[model samples]
Target: MKKTLYSLFVFFFFIAGLTNVRSQDISLPAPEKTGGKPLMQALNERQTTRSFTKDDLTLQQISDLLWAGWGVNRPDLKKRTAPSARDFQEISVYVALPGGLYLYDAFANTLKQIHNRNIGALSGTQAFVATAPVNLIYVADLGKLGKKEGDEIKDAELFWSYANTGFIAQNVYLYCASANLGCVIRGLVPKDKLAPEMGLKSNQVIILSQTIGVPQK
Candidate 1:
């Protein structure tokens, strides 16, 4: 009986260590730059329109969009085009494609597949969300922010979260302009229901979403 108990304890301890390592491995890397059009041109022509063609974005285009949105632009990773409150860097982008749902691994510059096949139905009340070739879902992890007391801190955090999201949205618009794609920043979805569908933790909040596709001519 003593031997069995000792072995069981060792096994559980090993399992616990493995779980911790796995979680750490899954943390996102800082974004990397993908050489594309000049920022000046992308910014000059950027515009938001809801009308999109029923065509998908290529992997390259998706990559560039993610990079522009929040990918690291410098070696130190201290600077990003999008500002995060207190360097919490809590914002995460979930890419919804006809093929399936994926989380953008900015550091890896790769799309990590989450679900197999289209789950566009998850974006409620927005038929465009279902039809657009790609939908970018911006989720903010509140746990990353330092704990605080009072509504003042909470309100400040909320504002910063939305502001960070806008930075990403504008990046997408610029990418669309440069690539001749159609895009729109949407805030119409029911985030409460959408959050569970994306398999997010209680601390993760969906702040905004956008649709990207070829323009209907």
Candidate 2:
């Protein structure tokens, strides 16, 4: 009877572990695009300007920006503005706003509030993070890239994560160009502090932050 009880406990434990793994899968929201000036015009006008006007973006504009940055674009669900290694969309954007911090839910096409107010202090000492109308914090989940046979291969996957993040950042830059907004991507930040603040896992990495607002006149 003792052996049978032990066996049953182990079997249930294994099943529970699988259930927990399945619950963590994320489904991003559909991408929304608005008609605007051509891509070339936006690219030509694209400029990284750190100085920004103290103006907040409307919900529609915010939606468009996120869509352009990394939101899903196709009905087939295959392509995005940014390229992901092995089609593993490991990058997540955390929006830091005056009201609070929000995680962009791409699949749901909505912003889920992560905090009630500004928590830019956790990002860095820079005043820009706090003052900008919106700050996009890009994070990459290394584990999402999948397991490899060796440490070197794992490191390579991490590099791919960073590369893919740049793709998303550039997409945002171009989107800002079309919208005539000011933006800048910065890499200087305390990563260790940000990960926990953002509620990320141990294998996740904070790639960079982009501050966006109206251009200071």
Candidate 3:
């Protein structure tokens, strides 16, 4: 009887886990694309901030941050807020939060829940990464650029991707500055270990990661 009860317990636990993953599709409200501290002021305030508190970000902040990073700005042409190489728009932002991992769907303005695991720590080597409010993993999907599934993408082919990610990250930095938030774009990421955790394809390369949260005073 004890053995039979153990099986039932495992079955219920599995069902609860699936429910969690299905619940993270966040349909963010319309992003405010205008009225900030002006371009020149935002540029002056754009600086890297590392220290972070464990404060959770509000839904509006999350929406604004993702929108500023890569939301669709032009509905007619489907152009994003940040520029991409040849308009490839290859970079995919995977967010690791306390609840789970999610992919930021730029066009739909929603976060597609990928898995029910807190993989934020895998985003960076820093201790605070595990507990930060948000960690944005910038992954370059080569398949969008005509690369096949098993094609070995070289570093040379990734030059444009790296440059493209920088533009988006810079946008996030500026947004955080304007919002009085703290953020840092980090390159010291364990890609090989994190890629599998993020369930990325072989052609999808993780270029960099950025951590964001309230500043620790």
lDDT of 1 by residue, 73-181 (tens): 6647656666776777888899888877788777666677776667676764767677778888898877677543221334455777898899888888887888888
Q: 183 in model 2: Cα distance from truth in Å? A: 0.5
Q: Which tens-of-lDDT digit does each residue in 1-217 have in candidate 3? A: 9999999999999999988765668777888877778889988888888888888998788989999999888979999989998999999999888888899998888889898799999898989888798999999999999998899888999999999999999999999989889899999999999999999999899999999999887
Using TM-score, rank the candidates from best to worst.
3, 2, 1
Give lDDT tens digits, candidate 2, residues 91-189: 888988777778887767678776666766567557766667888888876667654323243455568778888999999999999888888888887
Each candidate structure's TM-score, on Cα atoms with residue i matched to residue i, is: 0.76, 0.77, 0.88
Which pairs of residues collide in model 2?
28-106, 28-107, 29-106, 29-107
On TM-score, the leading prediction is 3
Q: Candidate 2: what lDDT?
A: 0.78
> Which of 1 and 2 is the better model by TM-score?
2
Q: Give the TM-score comparing model 3 with the true structure, all chains together.
A: 0.88
Runs of candidate 1 exceeding 4 Å displacement: 1-41, 146-156
In model 3, the worst 10-residue window by lDDT is: 19-28
Overall lDDT per candidate, in order of appearance:
0.75, 0.78, 0.91
